[model samples]
Target chain A: MRLAVTGAGAVGRSVVELAGEYGHEVVAVADSSSAVVADAGLDPEALVTRKAEAGVVGDGDPGDALAADYDVLVEATPTTLGDAEPGFSHVRTALERDRHAVLANKGPVAERYADLRALARDGDGDVRFEATVGGAIPAISTVEDVEPGHVTAVRGVLNGTANFILTRMAAEGLDYDHVLAEAQDLGVAEADPSFDVDGTDAALKCVILANVLSFGAADDPADAREFTLDDADVEGIRDVPGSALRLAAEDGRTVRLIGEATGGTVRVAPRLVPENGTLAVSGTQNIVQIETSHAGRLNISGLGAGGPETASAVLSDVGRLG
Target chain B: MSDAPDGAPEDPEGADEADPAVDGGHDPGSSTHTVRLELVDEPGQLLAALQPIADNGGNLLSIYHERGNKTPRGRIPVEVDFEATADRFEVIVGALRDEGIAVMQAGTERYAEELTLLLVGHLIDTDLSDTLSRIEADASTSVADVSLAAPQGTAEASSARLRLEARTGETADALETVRGIAEEKGLRVVAPLAGVET
Candidate 1:
């Protein structure tokens, strides 16, 4: 399959760099400002180097690459909130033209899911977003395999930055500010870190999962309920002091920012889990726990974020489309 | 036993000395007893009847007080379930009778289930004892144990871990009781994942 990639970020560059090894060709690539389009396959090294040194992928208009001939459009742009624009528009263009859209952006799926579903239904192409939930863990696909109707609930430690901060605080007996600073220095958490710690990021991911479960289980798509960030009951770890963790630890337990999504609701909060439990993943790691009817509880754990880690999920999504 | 009156059971010994073994030989370690009493439909009558059970080291399990259901004498019927040693069970019954409360029946019963959670906030300022008393007074729930950590001082934010033993199948009601208290006090509660034992 031929791929047209957008947003020259870490994930986009990694997808372009690794597409060849996966037996796929990158026909067009675009960043915010420029685009490089070729009827034949473009050179991965040249495009990445141009993006590095020249700060642009090519001289063509970014819209030109959207019009380029490709089988799948990979939307790896930074996620935006309401409307989820540029990324949503990019996906819409691909589906409108009967081309598949694989997304690494959470905004489109988390915010505008019904719109994307409507487009996918009308067009001949399919839509799959395995990367939007858990980076390298096969969370979305596993839920799909179990068949959403049979699954009771999907929950996990979805945010690595929040988990890292909590883990360090419990281990070192430090306050939230002190451990968050250490996490920022180690690059485990962003400098701003509001989205990760304030529970918005985790809530968004759980909202996406709730959308999948709700829509997937419904017999008719129109009758299914759609979830957005506003529907979630979210609580962050910012107010969780060291004393809380200490109190929890004394009873062989610890606090983690756990996000849960069922067909009807979405909630994220600091919950007390056993000290060495499966959901108590240490450091920058993630775990997805699925409760199903036929099959018992299933747990999937791995790196939740990174360039190649997330890009791998995108490429596998493409492979699934074929 | 079938022909006995509501407030009085037919037995050789007095109501307080009813045999635990005769009610079906339950485990010897501890046994639960259901004691039915008649109240005068007064304000402190229910509390007056329950004070003896708690004062005599009985683990109160549940209290089914139907205000609308009254005896022919205009007295209210209240059934209380509690767990205690065989000797303490006798002592509690004696205490209730000594308080001028009628004892309808005392027989073996069973109660089981426990929930653990954490509360985070200015617990000292909010009157931790009052918070606990309110929880105990709300439902058939009792705070089995509590561990408080006020490392930063009593004025700052603190945390408390509470282990509650509730009647079987009443976990949801017990949690709701705690959540209501926490919300009113402006505190945060970290509850365990329900039905998922880690």
Candidate 2:
């Protein structure tokens, strides 16, 4: 597939760089300020180096990439809430031109799911967002394979930063502040870790999962329930003290920010789980556990974030479009 | 079953006594019975309590001894399941009580499910005892065990791990009750993932 990539973040860069190995060509690429377009494939090394040296992908308008000729639009922009801005508009442009769209941004799928679906239905393109939920974990695809109607629930430790802090707090008997500081130092958490620590990031992932489950299970797309971040009942790990982890540890358990999505609801909270259990993935690892009606329970765990890790999921979605 | 709290299957035994032929669910005169007992946390207390059921022609089924959990009076809570005729069940209850064993609940009123959760915040300032009693006051739940950690004294934030025993299939209700109480108290509840066992 010929891909037009947007948002020059880690995911977007990796998707551009690795598209060749995945047997695809990146015809267009864009960051916030600039874009580059070439009918004949763009050079991955030149793009990456240009972004590093000049802080921009090219001299073309960012909207030029949206109009670029491509078979798939890889929407890898930083996720935004509410209207799900420029990312949603980027995907809409692709589908409007009858090109498939693979999203690394959670905004379009999570907040404006119904609108995205409406666009996909009217156009010849199909939408797939495996990366929007569990990074490298094939959560959405596995649920698709099981057939969403047969899957009862999908849940997991979706966030790495929250899991890392909780794991360290339990292991070292430290409070949230100390472990969060350690996480920031290790680059596991961002400078303003409110979204990761406050459970918004995980909630967004579950909201996306809930959208998938709801839409996938409905016989008619019109009958499905659309979920957004506001529909989630989220609780962060910021308030969890060392004493709570201590109490859980005494009972052979620990805490993790677990996100769950059923066909009807989405919830993210710091839940007590068995210390050695599958969901209690240590460090920055993530786990997705799907409960099905006939096939029993399915668990998928791996690195939930990082440029290449998430980019790999985006590439896989492109492969599926083939 | 592990979650047969309040001995659901045993309740029919009582109704069956009036019309054994109508029920025909179990053996003509034999059915399972679960008795909740408060035994003194002592070496021979369990054996002494069980002897009554066996002495009264009740065949032991299973014993769930919660030694770590205690009643308000500090007595260990034990749940004993057994198969007995309707007539023998009455005798077993009488015999256990006569032996000074506090039969907290007998026959059909047993808790079948257990859940543990952590509450963090100003637990002491919010009247933790009232929070617990409110949870207990809910017909479907009882406070099984609690371990409190107040590292910075009672005035500051503290944590308490509460183990609750809820009637069969009422774990969600029990959690809702606790959540309501915790919300009013400004406490954060780290609840266990329901229906997900390791």
Candidate 3:
């Protein structure tokens, strides 16, 4: 497959490396700083060095450089769902050119799923976004497996940094600040952790889920309720007697960062599960449990976040396309 | 703004000569209290925790059940909120412990809002279940709902959209946390468009 990769961030970098290994011809690479194109094929190793030196990837703007010939346009730009003009432009151009697309950026899809889907259909191209949600988890596939009419609700722990911090707090009894610092140091969190803590990320995700399960279209991020872990009073959890200790009680259950969409409304928050429940065992592990009208309750849990794991998912998509 | 003379509108009929004991009914300034408790993994643990609040003159307002998670000791953490007088609040805490419910943390603070996210990826192929578990471990957030779609099987490239709600105004952090997962798992994030002013 001839591929054009946009963004060059962590996921983009992984896609480039994997696509090269898979013997796919990476025709062009786009980013904010620079764009690299090769007729024969660019060396992933050399491109990495160039990216580091140039401090950018792809063309500064979406123009002929990205709109050039390609079989598949792989988008991996920074996700800005509502205001992702750059990603949207790049994707729109690729689709307009009758190229297939595999997206890692959430901005374009979250904001314009319906339009994009329609565009893809009109262009007779495939747009697959397995990496958009659940990291390496095959959540979309799971939902697809069940009868759409039978599925009643969807829920899970969708964020990793917040979970990492919560795990640290649960294990070490550390404050939010300390746990967050540790997450950054461990590379589990970003330098700017606002998105993870503020819940905007989760809201965007909810919009996507609602689109897939209910409307067959994504909703506006503004339409969903938003919250963040930062608003939680950890000190309050400690100040009260038996508060912190109860989390570790012999029969206590603790599950953090939960999201649920039931009926017509979608809600997300932190919840304490009863011991002996499936969620109670989901410690530092990403889990998604779906309740359906026919399947009752089904739970899926695994390591949904990580480079190699996510790369494998992308590779799977490439294989399927092949 | 007009200023009326003190005691000028005093009307004999409007004057209440009722009992002095009822001078001030239900002090509006009275502070509400909250309690955090840990319960054994039992079916009625939540009910056991709530009994204390009701028995101690506390009106239940909210409850935060940190379940489907575990502590280092493998126990569950639960946060409960209720309205009560200062004296009655303390009694509620005592009653919870007496009923064998592990009290974790409690105070006047309440979870005013929650945020949720749906993650789509090869959750099973990439071990997304573990990721969900890790996310739920965060004290600030909890796994409220999940929906998985793996029509091609777990090993195949698939997507699972997870919904996660966090404390009020914590959506940014929640998404960031998810971004970390996306970065780690190489998953494409397709929703929650940025800069939409949600």
Candidate 4:
């Protein structure tokens, strides 16, 4: 597959490297300010090195890479909340051109799955975003094994940063602020971290899962009826104190930032998880539990963050296209 | 069991009988055991259910998985005939349960041993799901059935009847896993002095 990546961050670089390792050609690459295009295929390692050293991937702008020729547009750009801009428009552009778009950016999928799928249906293009939900966990593909309508619900600890904060507070008996500081120091939580600690990240990922499950009112760019982030009742771990964790622990349970979706409804809250239960996955790791009507409940857990992890999912999506 | 055919033992009565040597998949203690299983009607269901059997020393003889007929549970009814020794049969059934593959019936062998106990505590409030999961996660046990009694409501207190199936001598190990969960949850465990309850 010939590829063009939008984000020149860690995930985008990993995708390019893995694509090259898997023998796929990276026809174009871009960062926030620079875009590179090579009809004969760019050297992935060299391109990544250039981005790191020069703070730019190439001489051109992001629009050049978006307009560049490629079989699949790999959108790993940073997520935007409201309109889900650049990422949303890039995917729309790819589909409009009858080309495939594999996404790692959660904004577009959480905000526009209906519109994207509707567009893909009208054209020769299609979309796959396994990396959007649970990072490297095969949340979408594993559930795909069951017949479409058979999956009753999908639930999981989707946000690594939120989960890390919660788990640390629970285990160390520390308050949210202390744990947040620790997580920030460990590089698990970003400096601002509002998007993650405020439940927006998990809500977006849950909405994406809802959309992938075709929750009917699945989330969309238009913020459709059923599964929009607006409709989701999200409660972040910010207010959950270490005292709450101690109380739950006394009862042989722990609190985890759980995201849930059954049909049109999607929510993210601190749900009680068994200390040893399958959903009790901790730290920066992520886990997803899918309840299928037939095949029973299936749980998938693994590294849910990192460039290679997300890229691993992106490459798998690309492979599915092939 | 068939006696090895000696040169002088080619009797007239054995003319139409099946030759043990020609049974194709025959081994010394191997017997064709008919095991019934209920599986989900989905792709890879049969393979997932059958892999454990093969892994635990059961050789595939035939699969009578009926797609048209489902069990009362609405799952596909699959009847499998396989060749395995008596001891191998015990391991096979346990493995099936470990894989979460429903072994509806495995010939005359049903997990070799069963242990049931009474757990009294706040099952729901203290997270009964976690308690049950920990026991099930132990390789030695699987929760065959559970009965919870919370007449006073979930807040007050509750007791559950857990039917656990263990490998032949692993009943003690299964009981230990149960005991561990009980101790951790501040729950009381009641063990019957009688032989065993079905």
Candidate 5:
């Protein structure tokens, strides 16, 4: 299959690299600034080097990649709220052209899932966004596999940055600020880490999953619509006092930032995860727990976000297009 | 472990079927052993104590986290029961202590055989709860079932039938605890029942 990626960030670069290793031809690749389009397969290595050296993937306009001859359009751009523009438009363009869209961006799914589905239905193309939620953890596919319409709830430790800070704070008895600084230095957190620390990233994933559990599966007769991030009740880990973790620790409990979506309601808050309980996962690890009517409770855990880790999910969705 | 927590198990209907250990459903290739650790009531300490069990290939059967019960060191006594091959048990225990956790005990738990005994004494004069506790302390013994025939009321002589599960080799240890309590309370002990002479 020929691939066209819209965002040449960490995840996009990884997808290109792995696609080459897996023998998939990437005919087009684009950064926000520029794009490289080839009627023949584009060199994945040259694209990576060009992005690093010139800050642009190639000299061609991104419009060319969008309209390029490709079977799949890989949307790996940053998430935007309101209309989820650019990523949304890129995906829509691919779908309108009867091309599959595999997204690592959260915006298109969380904000415009219904519209995307409608567009997909109107055209011959379909959309898959496994990387939007649990990176390479297979959260979306695992729940979908367990008989459609049986999922009662999906809860998880979705943000690895928050989990890393919390785990370090607890283990070292350091304050949140101290651990946060250490985390930032370790590249575990972004310099402006408000999005992750404020739980917006997690909320977006939860909202997307909530949309999937509710609006996905055309035959289920469940409401087919998007669940915007605004509908989620999100709280960040920024204000979780070290004293609170200490107190819970005294009771053999640990604090974890848990995002839960069930019954049309979604929330992200710091809660008492039992010390030895299944939710007491440490460091940057993530766990997505799905409760179903038929399969009982199933848990899947792995790296929630990373270059190769999240890219693996995007490529898996591409392979699945066949 | 403890019935898969309060709300975790999917089946509410057959949730209380039986304990997994007693059902002989446990893999015969591996045996059950309980590790006792006193953890500082800190956030990651429990995870710290439990990681080695998983790292050493010990499958956790149940965790008896005595959060309310603390040692003189102001730490909680957590008993984690797990299944591992005999060879891995030592490594698991070593890993637990190497994490700087206090391992109170780590050994095979054999409370499988059942034994019944009779104790006759003053109904309420001596504390029955204390007597029962002592009979179970540091021994592979648990009161599986009990019957008290106290027709004469709380102030009179009452005999109690106690059915206990014990490690076959450690039956004498359990019986000794009962005998010690019986001697202190001047209670007549009639042991060695017909069917449970072992």
Candidate 6:
């Protein structure tokens, strides 16, 4: 397979390396920085060295540009909702050029789910965004494979940074600031950190999940209720004896942020699960527990937010496309 | 007559009449404001934070409660909007801190700008996850998007293109942060060939 990658950040780089390892030919690589096109395929190791030499960061149009003949387009650019100029433009261009698109960016899907899905439907190509929801958990693919009547609800630790913080708070008794600083130091959180902490990132993922599970509702993503724990009273919990435990415990069950869109009302929030529940034990790792009407609850867990993990998911999608 | 003495002719209508100054006091055209707050993960955290806003006469618009989402510090991010006087807004924010909710941004007007950059290298073999984490940690930037391709397997070196969204006016700082990570991990930073605003 001849592949073209847009965006040369962590996940993009991982896709290149992994695809190369899987015996695919990486033909073109693009980023905000210079795009590199190689006829004989570029060496990943050397490319990394070159990027280091140049001081590059953030997003821009692909530098090297895409070849008309590439078999697949792996879209892994930064996510920005409402503003569809770069990511939307890039994906649309790839699809227009007849390349199979494997999207890791949530912005395009969250903001333009209908338009992009329609484009895929109209074109003689396939578009997969499993990496958009869970980095390596295969949540989307699992849902796709289930017997239509078997699956019920999808829930888990969709966001790793939040889970990590909660875990630290629960086990280590660390203050929020101290734990967050440690998370930053450990590469578990971003510098701006608002997206992860504020619920937008999770909301975007929920939107993607809703699309996958709902099978294309012609509704706006903004309609979903997005609530972050920011406004919740933490001190009040301490005052309420066992409030932490109670918050984590419900109906004699532990809790997790569960996103359910069954029967129309799409809800995403922290809900209590039984202690014996699969999601309760999901821990800091990224886990997706899909409860089908028949299959009951099936849990999938792994490194959910890392670049390499996301790249691997993209590779899997590419393989399927091939 | 003696008790009615000096300053006023006691008209019973004086107390019943509405003061002209008081009648014209309220304005309906004031714009509503929203604040984005980042909170650390803990039990019963949000309630304490809301006390100040409620006490200070801030009308609650919406609370984006991302309990499942965590910040780099393992905290949750929350966005709250309210209608209040500008002077009262400050009091609400102060009261929130007094109750202990970390304010990430008080207003929607972004103090941070966005910059996009590209990275090229053997991202997989070199542990692209670590590389991304490092850059994000340094510049307080987020991994917005990443596109990668390797026709070959993991052992074979391949290149990836990354799209990063960093803080506004912090592009230079973000780039420096990426540079440090690239150097440490032996990755290449591909300077933008064509520049465009994010």
TM-score winner among the candidates? 2
Candidate 6 residue lDDT tens string, B45-151: 78777778878877676688887877533667788866666577768866775654655556543224333333444667888888877765663565544545544
lDDT by candidate, in order shown? 0.88, 0.89, 0.61, 0.77, 0.78, 0.62
- Which ranges of candidate 3 are over 4 A from the true structure? A57-65, A216-251, A280-284, B1-198
Off by over 4 Å in 1: B1-111
Better of 1 and 5 by lDDT: 1
Q: What is the lDDT, from 0 to 100, of the residue A88 in candidate 6?
A: 78
Every model's TM-score on chain B: 0.50, 0.58, 0.46, 0.52, 0.45, 0.43
Q: Which stretches of model 5 miss by more than 4 angstroms?
A: A217-222, B1-198
lDDT of 2 by residue, A3-113 (tens): 999999999999999999999999999999999999999999999999999999999999999999899999999999999998999999999999999999999998999
Q: Give each prediction's root-mean-square deviation over alpha carbons.
A: 10.1, 6.2, 18.1, 16.8, 20.1, 21.3
Output the lDDT of residue A201, model 4: 90
Off by over 4 Å in 6: A56-64, A147-150, A216-255, A261-263, A274-276, B1-198
The fnat score for candidate 3 comes to 0.02
- lDDT per residue for candidate 6 within A1-322, as digits (tens), equals 8888888788988887788787797777787766777767767876666666774422333544555358788888898777545787777877877778889988887777767876776777789888988788898888878842356556556777766665565455444567678888988878766676555666667666766655532244344332222212111111111223332332233334444433233444443344454555443577776767776667798877888999988888888885
C-alpha DockQ for predicted model 5: 0.02
Instruction: Assign candidate 6 its CAPRI class.
Output: incorrect
Error of 6 at B107 (Å): 55
Binned by DockQ into CAPRI classes (incorrect, acceptable, medium, high), candidate 5 is incorrect
lDDT over C-alpha atoms for residue A97 of model 2: 96
lDDT tens digits, residue span B1-198, model 5: 354543222433354555444433243345567766678888999898889998888788789998888753377988898776667877887687567676655564445455556566673578787877777675577664455665547755665666666775777778788877888887755453222111
Kindly list the per-residue Cα lDDT of model 1 for residues A1-322, writing each as its tens digit: 9999999999999999999989999999999999999889999999999999999999999999999999999999999999999899999999999999999999999999999999999999999999999899999999999999999999999999999999999999999999999998999889899999999999999999999999999999999999999999999999898999988887778899999999999999999888888888998899999999999999999999999999999999999998
Clashing pairs in 4: A111-A220, A111-A221, A112-A220, A112-A221
Superior candidate under lDDT, 1 versus 6: 1
| DockQ category of candidate 4 | incorrect
Docking class of 2: acceptable
Q: Which pairs clash in model 1?
A: none
